[model samples]
Each structure stands twice: as structure tokens, then as C-alpha cells.
Target: MSRAQIEPGGCLILAGTPIGDFRDASPALRETLAEADIIAAEDTRVLRTLLQRLGVTTSARSVSYFEGNEASRTTGLMEEMLAGARVVVVTDAGMPSVSDPGYRLVAAAIEGGIRVTSVPGPSAVLTALTISGLPVNRFCFEGFLPRKAGERRRRLGALTAETRTMVFFEAPHRLADFLTDAAEIFGVDRRCAVCREITKPNEEVVRGGLGDLVSWATDHARGEITVVVQGAPARVVDIDGALARVRELVADGVRFSAAVAQVATATGMRRKDLYEQALAKREEHEDG
Candidate 1:
């Protein structure tokens, strides 16, 4: 497609760079980097380092599109893609636009009818989460928390009841403070993990209660820090509440047996157990 008059606009490729080990990068990511018409990097210097590590040379014009200049640069990059140029975005590490620059450019590319795709590779959030020995079935990646202590606490406080595994990126210097505050709010006994320098030489994962991690982070926290916190424990289903619900359903003109079955299914209790309990409670009430 000619740059001057293309039928369809060029594509925006979000290239995922290895968070630590360069070898984790896919062949597609390297080729896309080498062949792109333009590459927008969160840190041009870091991109150059990665190019060296991957032993790949690229002539694509590299431009800085980080938080500070992202707003100004998105338009130019979008214009380039509009002209049938294959533009790729890479962050210092991991995928672009996750706690990094690239979202604005991607949004603009989509708005201008440019095709958007990705060369998926490594992700620190997933790396830390999996290695942290935390639950993987359900998780929520909470990118860097608020820098201010107050805001950070408020944000964490709001997630006190979260039941899914929680992951967060924190600066090495702030890891200790974050752990300490989390221990206080999430409770000292809350199980957690601190994954430091993930997938890199000297990588370390420390798992323990929040109380224990606070002390560990003070001395051992270094490199890129991703904390995988155990989510607030599942709230115990109140047996009495289930029984009361069954009564309410029966009082609403539903038959007692059906009410017991519905409440049992909803509350994860056996129908026989709930039915027996409800009958016993009714008998006790009548006798009283």
C-alpha cells in the first residue's frame, strides 16, 4: 500500500517485550520490531537495549511516546498509520498500554479505522502472579497504586473484600511501605507474595502473611516489584441467612419444598440439610 493513497489504513501493532529475560520474546515480536515503518517506544533507550539483547537491527524511526509526551505524539503516529504505515508500540518492558504508554495511540488508530493487533510475548503481571504461588484461576491486575500514601490506602481499602487474586506493580522503594499499609488494612494475617526481579537473574519470590512480607520487603525488595496479594477470603455463607431466605421464599407463596431447594442451590447447601433445619426451626417456633 502506498503511503499517499491507501485503500485501508495501516495497522497498529502493540508489541509485547520481555519483562526481564529477552529470550521470552516471540519470533514474531522481533520481526515486527525490525520491519515496522515506525516504532513508538516508551523509552527509546530501553528499546535500543532490547534490540541489542535480541541481536536484531531495525531501521524503523524510533520515537518517544511516554506519559509526558504521549498526548502530543499520538496524533503523528496515528497519521502515519492512516497512510498505510505499519506502526508498532513497545514499552520499556512487557506489553504497551498496561501502566505504560500506548493506550492513546491505540485509541487514535482505532478511531481512524486503522487495524490494531498485537505480537504477544511476556507480561510481568502474569509472570509474577503465576510464580507468586497464588491462585491463578481468578485474578485482577491492579497496576501501580496511588503514589500518595492516603490515596493508596483508600484504593486498597476499597478492595478489602475482593475475592479474586490481586496483582500490583510497585516501585522498589515503595514496596515496603505498600506491604506495611496492606498488612494494616488487609489484616496482618492475610497471605501474600512479593515477586522481585521476575524471570531475571537473581529473581526472588517471598510468600507469607502480609505481616511477614512487610519485613521482607524492607531488606530484600529490589528490581521490578510485582506483589501478588491473596484476595480477601471468601465470606462464609451464613446458614441462618440461608434459612431466613428459604422462609421468605415460602412466605412469598412458593411451596416449602421448592423454597428449600432454591435456597439450598443458591447458598451451596444441600437441600436435605436445609429442609431438615427449616422444619426443625418451624417446630421449635410452634412449640415456643
Candidate 2:
């Protein structure tokens, strides 16, 4: 277990690759690439290109470890690590486990008593958030949204009242649709920042309300996209306001019960309390 000895059970290294500019790569990454006995990469071809760009040459065995094959490949990678081989996991970009492979291998490695370490590098999430001109004091990373419109809207609706800033990775082609849905659910006036092709030449960051960004995406927006959205504005919990929202939805053709459920969910209020209050209000209005 000494530093000089690659014990019968070695360690797993989770290396972070640059999200855009290769120059942002750390020296630790180079050392890991050169020293790892086995390199599990999301894409071997892309790894080769990165190695070439960094002028790094290694004798380690390179294997594909992307989403499509990660499950099947975990066993073999774990076996190598348990057999005293230094295994390094790298995704196409950013850290391996964040919206990428390496989770399975890391978990298996730990379960097998193997050590796991990371060589941190540039992250699209952090990169976009810091430069997004949005509040970063408290934020959450929502990797990607459902591709289907209905499902995406439902998922977004669930976060309509989220107060913490949110970050999301999105495909260039889906940028417009994603923004459009976000605008409708989060509101047209909600502030957001769309960062594209970060760190590389032609990088662009569009900051504005959801409505303005949607209009911009209609004509521009390409490359890797990371969106930072301002959290919902803070509001005091008001029973009257909650009831009003329920009534509005009910007027929009939603069933009274369903509207109560939706408003309760969005406002984090007790559904029973909202239902009771709404019912009383309706009865009073009808009597008056």
C-alpha cells in the first residue's frame, strides 16, 4: 500500500477534461495520463485527439467507456484496478461523473476497497455560472431536460417556484425549444443567461429575461450551451394569493381539485388547507 508499490488493489483516478479550451487542462491531467496503467475514456478517439493536442504520449491501454457501454465495461475496469493497475477515468469533457460515465466504475471501485481520486479541471457549469451575470450564491445543476415537449414542460412546471439559481446543459438545436418552454413555465420576465461555446473562440453569452433570450435563440445560438436562470422571486406565503392562483387555474378549464393540487404543489402549501380555504371562498362568493 506504499506510494512506490501498486498494491494488489490500486486506485481509481477520475480526471476532469477541459470543457472547451484545451489549454485549460491541468498538469495533473498530463501526469495522470502518462502514469495510468489503464485509461477508460468516454471516447478513445476524442482522447487521442486531446492527447495529441497536449503533446502527451502514453503506453497505457485506452478503452471506450461512454454511456452506451459504461455498464458492461465497469466490471472489467474494476478488475484492472483490483489487480494493481492504475485506472484513470475521463469523459469527453468536464468531470467524469457529472452527467457522464465514471459513476459506475467509481462506485464499483469503492465497493471493492479501491481508492478513488480526481484531477479537477474546467467545468461548463461553473464556467457558465460565474460569467452568466446571474446570482450564483445558491444554485443547482439540472443536467438536461426531457426532449419531449409535454414531458419537458411538466418537469419545468415542477420547478416553477424554485428559488435557487439553476443551471442546465442543453443541445444547440434544442436551445430554442428549451428556452421557449422555460419562458412559459418560469415566466417571460424571469432572467436567464445562455452561454455557448464557452472557453473557445466564438464563445458567446446572451444574458436577458427568458422572453428576450427566446427571441435571440430564434436566430442565433450554437455549440455547447449552458443556461443559468435566476431563481423565482421571493414572496411571502399568503393563503389568499395561493387561493387566487388556484382560482385562476380553475377558470382556465382545470378541474377545481386539480387546480388546488397544482397550486399547492407550486407554492409548497398544504393541499388540504388550500382545498379547504378555496372551498370556503367559493361558497362565500356564490352566497354573496
Q: Which candidate comes out best when scored by TM-score?
A: 2
Put down candidate 1 lDDT per residue, 114-214, tens digits, no spaces. 88888887888988888888889999989999999999987886687687899999999999999999999889988898888888999888889999888
The positional error of residue 125 in candidate 1, measured at the CA in angstroms, is 0.9
lDDT by residue (1-288, candidate 2, tens digit) is 322134445788889999989999888888779877899999999999999999888999999999899889999888887788889889999999998888888889878988887888899999999999888899999999899999988888878778999999999889999999999999999999999999989999999999988878978988888999999887567888998988899889989998888887788788898999999999998999
lDDT of each: 0.85, 0.88
Following a full C-alpha superposition, what root-mean-square deviation does model 1 have from the true structure?
A: 8.8
In candidate 1, stretches whose alpha carbon ends up further than 4 angstroms from where it belongs are 1-9, 236-288
In order of appearance, the predictions have TM-scores of 0.79, 0.90
The candidate that wins on lDDT is 2
Cand. 2 Cα-lDDT: 0.88
Q: Candidate 1: which pairs clash? A: none
TM-score between candidate 1 and the true structure = 0.79
